[model samples]
Target: MNIREYRAFFLDTLSKAYDAAEAESLFYICLEELKGWKKVDLAMNSNAELDRVELVKWNEVLTQLEQERPIQYIFGNAHFYGLEFFVDENTLIPRPETEELVEWIINENKGKKDIKILDIGTGSGCIAITLAKNLPQAKVYAIDVSKDALAKARGNAVRNEADVTFIEKDILVADSLPESFDVIVSNPPYVRNLEKQEIKNNVLQYEPHLALFVDDNDPLLFYRKIAKLGDRSLTGNGKIYFEINQYLGPQTVTMLQEEGYKNVILKKDIYGNDRMVSCDV
Candidate 1:
């Protein structure tokens, strides 16, 4: 069948799972990745026929989408801070809110010299790689507990041509860092089990759970441990940043203050939800 015919079928098949507008968007994204055809190309070549192999690939993607697999996972790539990184079942797809966190860090320390930055739980190394690429003088390091995740993160650092040191260590059990850092940042697992209903099925089903969830009884498990680590590892003027759960913003800020951090500040994302916090050592 031709492009136009297949487009109609794709939208209709996805209608039950996604709204018309979202279905349209997903259809175009799939077409661009699977066949290198954009909207204008589709408009100009509406009658262009799909060969048997191409049709089969499209059908497979359609099946996956119906199964609620993320499109980024299907294509094995996701864009973050203007760079594309490889993603799979091993890593969580990068989100736009996390881009804001990256931007906030870059804005605060754009031209510093010889600064060291550490990203804890750097599942895909999105934060560390972006910092290295944007701040050429800064030394960036990333840590993740999962070897599979770290392997992909290392590959991403090479793909982006951003020099970063990837370490395999679990922060909860570690007593000290390898060295001090001017800045420490994390977007760790903050979603509580009680809030699982708020998460979309595609995320809850397809993304790595170890990277998405925390215990409902102690949701700040990572924050508490990382804060303790920062207390010992931060340079005298070092600052720490976190992308937090909106529901626990005030609690996170209070925890930092109790840990003796100064200038504790909670900031909101574009959606105006309290999503980020920062403080000094």
Candidate 2:
């Protein structure tokens, strides 16, 4: 089938499961991947035909999409901060909000020299590596409890050519970091287990539970642990940054303040929900 006909069929098939816009975008992404053609090429060469092999591959991707599989997982790579990183079930797919958190850190510490940055629960090493890449003079270190996650993070460091030290250590453990850092940041597992029902099935079912859930009774477990660690591991005038649960923003800031982190600030996201918190040590 030609590109135009296949795109229409693909969209029609997926529209039953997803909205028109998402379905169209998914179809176009697959087309670009399989045919090595961009949207401009599609517009100019609508008559371009797909060979038998290409058609089979396209159909396979379509089948996966119909089953609600994420296109990023299907492609095995995702774009973040203008860089591509490999992704899989071992790590959570990096989100745009997390990118915003990175931006906040970069902008807040733009001209600082020899800044020591530590990223706790650095899945795919996106935050740590992005900071390292953007701030070349900074020392970046990342830690994750799961070795599988750390392995992927290490690979991402190499892939991005960012010098990030990946360590396999649980952040909840008190004696993890041997030395202090200038900035500590994390996008830890803050989703309370009870909130599973509120999340889309595509995420709750497909994403790694280890990287997503915290006990409802102690939803702040990771936050508290990281806060204590940050207090112990930060240099004088150092800062702590967290991507927090919107529902628990004030509580999170209060927790950090009680732990002796001063100047606790809660920053709202684009949706006007409390999303990020930063504290000075």
Q: Number of the top candidate by TM-score?
A: 1
lDDT tens string, model 2, 22-95?
88888778877777778998999999888999888999998988888888889988889999898998889999
lDDT of 1 by residue, 113-200 (tens): 9999999999989999999999999999999999999999999999999999999999999999989999999999999999999999
Output the lDDT of residue 265, model 2. 91
Identify the runs in model 1 with alpha carbons over 4 angstroms from their true place: none
Clashing pairs in 2: none
lDDT of each: 0.95, 0.88
Q: For each of the candidates, give the backbone clash count.
A: 0, 0
Minimal lDDT window, size 10, model 2: 170-179
